[model samples]
Target: MEIYGCSVTDYSDRYEERLNLYKDKFEDRDESIFLEREMINFKDFHNVLVSIFNCFIKNNDYHKLINDPQFINHLNHLQNNYNDVFKELFQIGPPLLDANKNVSNPDDIKNEDNRGYIFYFDFTKEKVDNLIVSTKRILKYLNNKKLRLQKPRTPESEEEYKGSITTKETKPPKPSKIPAKWHALAYLIELKSKGLKPPINTEGAFIKLELEAIGRIKTGLKGQGFYREVSKHYKDLDKPEILNKSFGKDWKDTILKLFNSNIVLKEYIDKHY
Candidate 1:
């Protein structure tokens, strides 16, 4: 069963282990040198640090860390000296939730089946507020450097560059006729006036009149041939009704208008000729 956005069956013991590690590190202030030595990579070190930090934040006891004079002094020193490094290291992204609404343990996401829960941090919330502030400051500095490197351009030179490129104008292709029922004949006529082509089929006419009982076409004899041609095509049309049903009530009119319009019909004639 799915729970917390992930399958419950996929939950791993690693999640519990990570959670316990955070609890131990924060609650006991564990200062084991082995922990530091074991974290050989930046990723591993960041994970351990963020997990412990989150545990403290989530527990709503920020004072515990703040009250420690040494930790406070270290935090202040880092903010002043290596602020960029601290932001990069501590900006944890959004927590992944399982189908059961439980925050996914980062370790569990290493598996392929559980990968979907991993997402970038949502900047609108608490996860990256501090990080966002730091990023903005870094970006401002970079922008100033970029402005220094930029060179001014003359309008005459810009116009010459643009004139060197050529553009081609091509006509759009004509739309195909769609067949419909005889009860839809009037609708088809309205479309024909607008330059649309509606393909009528024999079988569809019978179905529309007998089964669907759509109203009959009321146009004069001059338009009879066009209606009959469409009806014949409708009977012969090979596609499924379910697929054609989505064409909408006025689709026949739209198609006929496109078929009758010189702008559209010219393309069809050009293609065939």
Candidate 2:
């Protein structure tokens, strides 16, 4: 016999004993005194069981029970035993989106369906577009400059070579030999001060910063590849709030002034070119 659809095995021994006593005294015989006592015991036991189950289910740690098949099965059995109780206590269906709408077609409605509506949120793509443009310009400049620097070797006859024993100048200018990493670090510092979040990888961030600096110094050193590379890393950092605040304007002016100071750029040109 089941009370509230729960089998005898599901209840504690005391509860089972009280339930059995109630059934035997109330239904099979005319012992009203014993029946009343056992009935009250059963009701108290059921309420205690329900309270304990409610506490367990409401706990945040109860989510761990999902990893145990036995626990999950036991929970399901308990749920079935007190289906009406459970239904009254918690939501049993998919979540609602806002008070008026159900989230039945989340994927279908996600793509601009509510665009232009006051309830819909839209992002301005202007900053991303400008980043793409500037990145491309810088990259193009770098690639072009690299190509131009590749010198052609002239072949000489053995007699001419022997007659002219002068040593070929292969030493790079002192400024060109200055590590590109330093330039990159300077640029990163400037960008950071202006609220841009630079890449966590120091080497990668420095390389990109140096490329942009190089592009600024040489107008003809444009390459789409350089732009794409720098833009890719820059966007990955994703601190667009800094750019949106027009900090790049001041950064650009400051970098230009430093470039013209003949302290860094002059040194680089003398060594490299």
Candidate 3:
């Protein structure tokens, strides 16, 4: 069954076949129920991962499946299927917070009784924390690798002639524009990593990236709404009056603070402001 818009077919036909075989041979006698049962529960990001992992384990090729094309396909499909889910998680209110009202450690947040919003995903806990931490690690790793691969190549300089030809000064490379939502999420991740809770109701929350602090702001009713809100804020940030009201007159310096963490956002601010 489809879960978060992903089904067994999305992983791979072969994997689905194998899953069916296992369902027939091992646990469920009802093929329809086994095939159609929901695999992901939005309250717990770990559900899909665990279900997939179980599938591999059932096939007795769990170790060999690493880096396998089909396995990667499954992960990619999972990522694609859960894209909206990720967006929602990043945008919503009642962020996970520790007893000190700071961002809670992923490990500490694993217990079902935790007072954080994430606890609603799976009441059982059950590796949910690991899923969150591992997902961040995997995303960061993939994002960095993608950045490296997409970087433009510089041409080799011609050998300088002795006092015959002058070489022109090379201009500094410009930063590419990353999605504003991406930069915002990255900043949020940075705050979480540092044990800071992102606030859910403050304007100019983006400025917190500069101060290495987390400010409050309600993202919005949905991921798209939140993105639109932040995008508009980012667009209007250049105004003197808006800056004066949201941040202090020293907003220029405050804005520069974001540059320290998110290079692409800094570049965006520089190019726009």
Candidate 4:
């Protein structure tokens, strides 16, 4: 059975672990020494990373791929949907050890485009499942990292950067009036207009946060609880009678107006919320 838009089986149990590792790697905090027994190489992993990003590029949905919770869920669903393809590919491979046994140094495998051989067989259901966990974790980390980087500079930081020493204490900046949903909605609609599809998974963490910020849902909801609430919300919205009354008959036009403006969604959301 499905909860919200996600199947219970679709989520990886290793999501949090993968997320932590992804953050450590992204921030250069991971100092763990590598071991040959790990059964994967830097080159092989790097190729997977490249392949993931390349998929986004080929679809012309890199922005959505990174920052859109729905899009991320869509990617997860796609990966899950290809289970048969993965199983079939894994059936035809000679052991990778045979290829590596001759090489004393892993570093000797330079500038190698081994994705053709590696991807085809390297991913058993279990291995791909682990990789899927890592992929989602990394995507979430990168998106949040990008958001943090885009956050507006505080007055104190700005002043310190300018080397201005003021004898007078500075007042804190006023809170912004904008809500987080607008930013999410704006981006979502833009991607839709561009013919990019987002996942039906409205229960994802980012979407939960956005909905909570708008007072449309309660805070601290997650997993099955989160999915149930969002699913109920969507069920309500799916009724044309309710939808028309809530957004008016021209809701699509109203939404288009909100998203079509050229303002940077994240910047405005950051500054305000």
For each candidate, what TM-score against the reference? 0.17, 0.19, 0.22, 0.23
Model 1, span 75-194: residue lDDT tens: 444444445644543334322211354343444444453333222322312443443343344334334433432323335666566756433532322322333333244343344335
Q: Which numbered prediction scores highest in TM-score against the true structure?
A: 4
lDDT of 2 by residue, 1-273 (tens): 133323332333344455466455334222222333333334433543444344344432322323345544544543566445334322332221123553333444444543422121111122223323443443343344334443334556666566554545634223433233333334443454345543234454433433443433322233223334445435422353544353443433344454565455445433422
In model 1, the worst 10-residue window by lDDT is 1-10
lDDT of 3 by residue, 43-109 (tens): 2345556654554554433223332455455555565766664334323443321135443334444
lDDT of 2 at 107: 48
TM-score (C-alpha, index-matched) for candidate 2:
0.19
Q: What is the descending TM-score order?
A: 4, 3, 2, 1
* Candidate 1: segments with Cα more than 4 A from true spot: 1-59, 67-74, 78-141, 144-148, 151-273
Looking at model 4, which ten-residue stretch has the lowest summed lDDT?
31-40
lDDT (10s digit) by residue, model 4, range 132-251 = 455454445444443554455567556465865554444433433433333334434444334443223455433332233222221222223433334343433336576466446765
Candidate 1: Cα lDDT at 80: 49
lDDT of 2: 0.38
TM-score of 1: 0.17
Best by lDDT: 3
lDDT of 1: 0.36
